[model samples]
Target: PVHDDDDDDDDALITDAITGKRYRALRHEEAESLSDHLLSLWMRAGPGRGAELPVDSYKESVLEAVRASQVVVMVVITGCGKTTRIPRFLLEGQVRRVRRAECNILVTQPRRISAVSVAHRVAQEMGPALRHCVGYQVRLESRPPERSGGALLFLTVGVLLRKLQSNPGLQGISHVIVDEVHERDVNTDLLLALLLSSIKNNPDLRVLLMSATGDTQRLSQYFGGCPVVHVPGFMHPVQARFLEEVLTEMGRPTPPRRDREEEKEVAPDLDLVADVIDHIHSNREPGKDAFRADRRGRAGRCQPGHSYHLFPRKQLDRMAVFPVPEILRTPLESVIIQAKIHCPHSKAVDFLAQVLDSPDSQVVRVAVKSLMDIGVLDAAENLTPLGERVACMSCDPRLGKALVLSALFSCVLPVLSVAACLTRDPFYNSMQNRALVSKAKAALSGSSCSDHLVFSRVVQSWKELQGRESKQEFLDQYTLSGASLRFIHGLMQQFGENLCEAGLLDASAECLRLSSGLNQHSQQEQLVKAVLIAGLYPHLIQVKRGTVTKGGRYRPENLSYRTESGPVLLHRSSANRGNPDLSSRWLTFFSAVKSNGQVFIRDSSVVHPLALLLLTDCDLSERGNARPNHSVLLPGHSLIRWEFSPHVWELLWDLRTSLQAMIHRSLRRCDRRSTSGGCKDSELVALLVELLNNTDPEPGSDQEEFSTENIRSDRL
Candidate 1:
């Protein structure tokens, strides 16, 4: 008999014997089983008090397939009970065949919303008595199963990957069901590869792949000829009307024909949709018209509904049968990092090649080069200590680096806010009143000349507000989304917890509070900006000064900036979009996008030259005999050069060396989970912060002595 006490304490740190790394252990309580009467009630009620789902009919087949094979594929249709019922089937089967405390089933969803909603629906169906056994986990939030076994856990793919980082074998899990494999997301694809490897070693483990629309045969072949189970959908008949049919029904003549060029543009015709809606509204009886809108291919299967297809049937048929997997379409840096962490011995390229759809070799090489350039991987493509810490985080590798550096610099609070904002912007821009939203953002930004800082300020101000009415008023005034702010807050807390798990921060609540305090120091803002530079290095933009007017005012339109990719305008939504009189010539931007044949930078910040000198990746060797100019060039960015006096350059070099050493030392301490040797270099961080504070020139100050110069590569 397995007791609940077999699970470790919530606060307990379990050390891995192989890597000698420590991580927080999960605590599970003994789950109370549902009463016989409650179970009878659930059976009588059925799913949502309806007839049995199509998936319910195939429950025995699914269970039998799982028992027969280590890998099973279920190609169920949408609206079937595959997402919720299949996991319950596996869990109950395991409970009856084995010890209830040893039956652990993990079902992976592609999105948090689905994972959470399905978990709630399943819990509701299971009755309140056994509700604790059904739970879900997503980034920054989770209601994990109460018991260690007889548990049906629903979690996002990314959450499961994070869990696998610590427990690669998934020691206690009996069945792993991956839902929505048709999504073909990077995480899902990667999860499939990892599970394929895991199943070979753990004969006791069963892997089930569920999808509504995917290449079933290909997935089965990838899983070594796995048994496939087909479950019909339970959706009512749907009436789908195409654009021409809708227009004919409405007795509206077609508009003028478009040119071939115009016909190639595949954007949705919103006007036609509105016309259809208006016709439906006018023709239908009062209160009889019901409409539902869903995106992608799931719209028609969302129940007994009428789906209006805006595009021609031929265009729909021309669309690819399956989406190009994210592994092939998206950047592979994060995937490569995770692959390295999962299989330390296997090469990243080799491991990724085993995926269902391997990325291009050139793309993989490029990702490896980026990781090496960022110091996350060595020349031999092995995970550096920094890489290990980065792998522990559930964020972008660059943002993870920023979080670790912020902790070392004692500026975790602001950096976390900035990272969260970058992950998901909290500011709301009303399409009706764009100017008002922009004005509100500019007012909040003040003279900081930073869109990133604007987010931090908004979050801080929202938190400081006293009452619900006050908070709502504050949000309304700033045009901020309260839900997005709450999400950012949750992400900040999650990041803090990740830092603790990485051993870079103390796990104590008091230490966490202090570390995440806003008023850490007088120069907290400068430190935060410097850390941003450290994280977003190579994303630097060289600012070109605009011509001054006769009144000594700078022309905003004349102001331009250039990144390595080429010239880019400030995004209209940025706080510094029209501000030309920036304090720093160098700007660090969060992201850039091309629109209308023009590139625009967003979420930019002005940083001191000293901060860039100390933080960014600079190659002294690139200077070589060019030292007479007392200038250094960033690797792969020869278009920009930083010129300082000989003495200043030497001073900056010494500071950079010391900072690097401190970071390495702190990482080592963190890896060892050392109590005596803390994860911060107090004196060094203080000196760096003070230098940044003092060196940051005020707006309109003539500080061109240490300024950066933009030179054409040909000139260099």
Candidate 2:
């Protein structure tokens, strides 16, 4: 049987003690029933079409290519049957090959849609025993093969990475194929780096990397001169006479930014890409005016050369990408409607719609919409799969938070922390009523960091509301914002499901098991923090000593700076209003803060300062003294900066590693328990202790590291 961890090559299938019928893996009917809820989601689009053979007479080329070489690079351009044909080819290959080389085929995508859709299509095409030959593995669910011999596995790059980490470099499957390399996601890039570095050591491993015509050269070079087999698509090649040649020249005086923006449509080898695209354009179906390129590639008008073989826009989704400076392109009407509902008549609301949706709004607007569409908008009216995934993470302001949250799945309370992190932005505006926020912050400082003061104050007012049972009443009496509460509720639901999927159905089992019958006071507390920490660990930033503000008190940047002074709350008037209690002191949480006209959270994670300082970069020195002292300035982002220690650096490294390991251990133990159902409370406690121990450092000295600390506190 294919265990949850297929990486466990030696693991024997579970068997019944009495019957010895070798726990005859789940029956098709039972499996279907169990996954009925999940399948209902896909099936809801109604029954879709299955894979089919090409209408044109057969070309053994597709199947033959994969069969001949261990690793095959099939460059079948858009619509020429790459997606469908490739998986079918592998199934055929498995049937023909007899040796152990008859292992499963792993096909990975840059997004979830392709992964999920492709698997369903493949299974429908393959017919019966798909449970044994065709399967899928994505973020929330999996339909893996029972015996694992010939199944074709479709997964996302992130999932594959986790599988690799889980199995320490892909233990099972003999063939490894990577699909869609041009998308250029962080995860895809990282996976390539890992494979490239290790393929030599893994001779049994056959690597197949595929992509569009434009960027396949790099893949070839990366694979140690692997022979490339190119299959031209129906797309006709067109030459872009020149970028300006295709772009309509403006008669009126145009702004330079606009002029500059126009050129971005044809970037880098602009002339070349546009040329080929134009050729494909002329040869496209007479009436299919879809899948066109944009000024800079937004969900806007398609460029001319999309004729021959561009992915039809109407048929599928736009290849939406957000690499560096993310864009939040949204329809004006939708953003305006959302803003009006969020905070009617408020300037921020008006600005949220305009500045973010202005004609010139590219990075921020597109980023916001992309974030929102994918569930990055914690306060969205409705949630989508991508959005749900973002909401599934701990609070940070980036789109890539799921990775960190995924790590937490193995830890106790990962669900709780993920809920809290995703639900509330951890720094409330303290300056709105600087005095009131000051009161809340002061009420929170030290004193167990449990919000004894803030909770008591809020509860006192809340209790006065007599009918606090109502969500609105409870929110109003406690001075809680509706937006914040909305996020929390949604986050709670999403995290709950995540725990269930990870096999830790009883949230109460992890301490946060506060769901009534599974109730206990302060139950959700540690779990919430633990999951948040788990998701936010590697980004940890401990506060540096001696960094104090001019007022001679603690700066919220570091826990070390927090003292008897009690200045731990966020300022009210400042913009980036995050939660007060969960907000880091010496820790600077990081995420992809989309640059809308106003900056807002995207994908994010929260953790200690030391964690990020240690893992992502090294505190190198000219002669042993620290060189790049700030942790955030290490790699990927030169603009990100955070000041902290280099001494506990190694200690922070060990701590983050330990914390992650604990989460993994907890997951394995829990998964095993489903079959074993027994674990020591002491063992659970031990994992929890590893996460919380030594979280605090000496109150930092009076120094200031941040140029400006934005706040949103109690009053506003």
Candidate 3:
């Protein structure tokens, strides 16, 4: 944010909270954050930055390697410009040099914005030779006169999957760049598996996987030895160090399971975040390092009575550093600073305020200056704007998972509560939050019903107020930290701006809704969670709902005995603990045991016994049974076995097939395609209602009341 005084409007440059670097503010009309500046360099980089290849060095080597083989998957590092340079290599003639080049170069990104951004950058570099040469295609957005000629297309991984699903041949695509493969996104993984199946026949397609160094190795092997290529980075070689045992350390940037998909197990990046943290910590002299002391008083609440930004009421003139606002910030992403305000407060707080206010932390202070050197406790003991964002995002520790989910379903709100579930988590050794995690989990189960994407749009809508002044005023009504309130506000603004820059103006509208308060927050995440299940189908852990808890807390009670059915909460992050706000629900047993024979007091929707039998559990093809028995046969990998009677088996199979087809269709239709102003979402509603209502195996015994015995049968 700009630091200015009415006394000297021209002195707008902000003082650094560390390393006394002074930057004179420029009165530019546009607003750009540090990330924007850095990323701008990437987007606008020219062949000027590229070193003249040693005639046959890196770029040529990559081309030669991929061209010789029918299928090539190569690993490259960040900053090496794989995303930027790979296309150049092909366009250089040797690859795409002459002859009627009919093949279209295709690239896929995790987020739609990344796809457009990369494509725009590449097209800019191609210049006049390719006015409309490079094009990008997203779910609802496309830019290309026609899909003819040799063109490079950038699209989201999910979008790519959808395209391939409809037309396996992919109608024109020669080279593919799956940038950031180390991320292991569900779409990317699935694309890999699916693409692998096509590799044997698609003689024209060549795949190149670009990943970060120090981490891409494993992903390389997973693909069975795609010739791995490494590019040395331009980052000033900072020291690299490792810490085998530090009581605790930062976890992965986003929860890998946010895609709502599951694998046999999680792949830890001890060599990434931890290693980087360790490298930083170990390099500094014990007594000379800096420390950060930032905390959030509480999160924002919706109230018509107060301003959400907490401004004009109890002015910052009375507070210090606003107790560091809670926002989710990663090292990457664009952030714009408007005005930086300093608060006045307690002695320690004041000291931190002063230190953070300093141009840099290289100097020392007597009372509080000494503490400024290390980040743990800022001289003023307050969080800098940057620190506050980091803290809020890190509040859940499992922010990675939450962020990952944001990318997929775009539901950061429920995950916001997931932060609560993360606080005071039961150690991985202990299952304290398991119950709630189970509940948070139910939000995403069942493929039979729909409303899957609604929750996503809901959270994205709720995120709108993050930076808006109205919201901060609302927070002031409570004793909430202004910084925390503003942090999220800023975070939302950042995401919104990114969506715009990514050219995700259309598809991102659903995600950008996180910044507009378009969708009212729904208590039910099932609508969104179900999509996660669809994406991560078959990788579930079912819980029975009728069992009672003994209350030791660490142990999980009886889980759904679904012959098949899980958001693999990040392996060991605080998500393992229940974020009270995020993970509040639990799975109950199936016995239908009444809390007092009341039977219908507090209840959760349970799946149909027959539905589970048809879709998840059944093997023996029995012939006479009319009802789906409580003991359903289960198939491994969640595929149901059909051991029931012909009547039961046929009925179950038909019901399941119908539900599956409808769900898959619903998944393909974007919320934007519907015109019913929310009413349009009824397709999923219709499917869910039908699935829920048709749970009875015996038409005569159609009971709406749910029995725990049929735990997996009830629909969302």
Give TM per candidate. Answer: 0.85, 0.45, 0.37
> Model 1: clashing residue pairs?
none
Better of 1 and 2 by lDDT: 1
- RMSD each, Å: 6.3, 17.3, 23.5
lDDT of 3 by residue, 253-304 (tens): 3322222122212334434544554544676455322231010111111111
| Candidate 2 ranges beyond 4 A from true positions | 1-59, 97-101, 128-132, 169-171, 196-202, 236-716
Predict model 3's lDDT versus the native: 0.39
In candidate 2, what are the lDDT values of residues 1-716, reduced to their tens digit? Answer: 22343343333343211121233333455444434432333334332234343412234665565556655555656645667666556555544443322355778887878888987776776555343456677765666654444457888876676555334335445667788765655456556655653455556666777765544554666555556777664543332222333332222232233343343342244444565556536754553333543321211222234222222232123333423311132233223322332233343233443221123434335545544432334343333332333332323323133333332333333334333543464334332435554454444333334332233234323334455367566563334555654444455455556545444445423433333322222233333334343334333333233346678886654433121212232223222234334333433333323232233323322333333332222233211335544343434333235553454344444544554444345444444245222244334434444333434422233444322112111111
Candidate 3, residue 159: lDDT: 58
**Per-residue error at 344 for model 2, in Å?**
52
**Where in model 1 is the C-alpha error above 4 Å?**
1-50, 98-101, 242-291, 295-303, 508-519, 546-557, 621-629, 671-681, 696-716
For model 1, what is the C-alpha lDDT against the true structure?
0.73
Most accurate candidate by lDDT: 1
Whole-model Cα lDDT per candidate? 0.73, 0.43, 0.39
Q: What are the per-residue Cα lDDT tens digits for candidate 1 across 545-648?
A: 66567799887557767888887888888888878678777788877777657888877998877777777655654353545556577666755566665555
Deviation from truth (RMSD, Å), model 2:
17.3
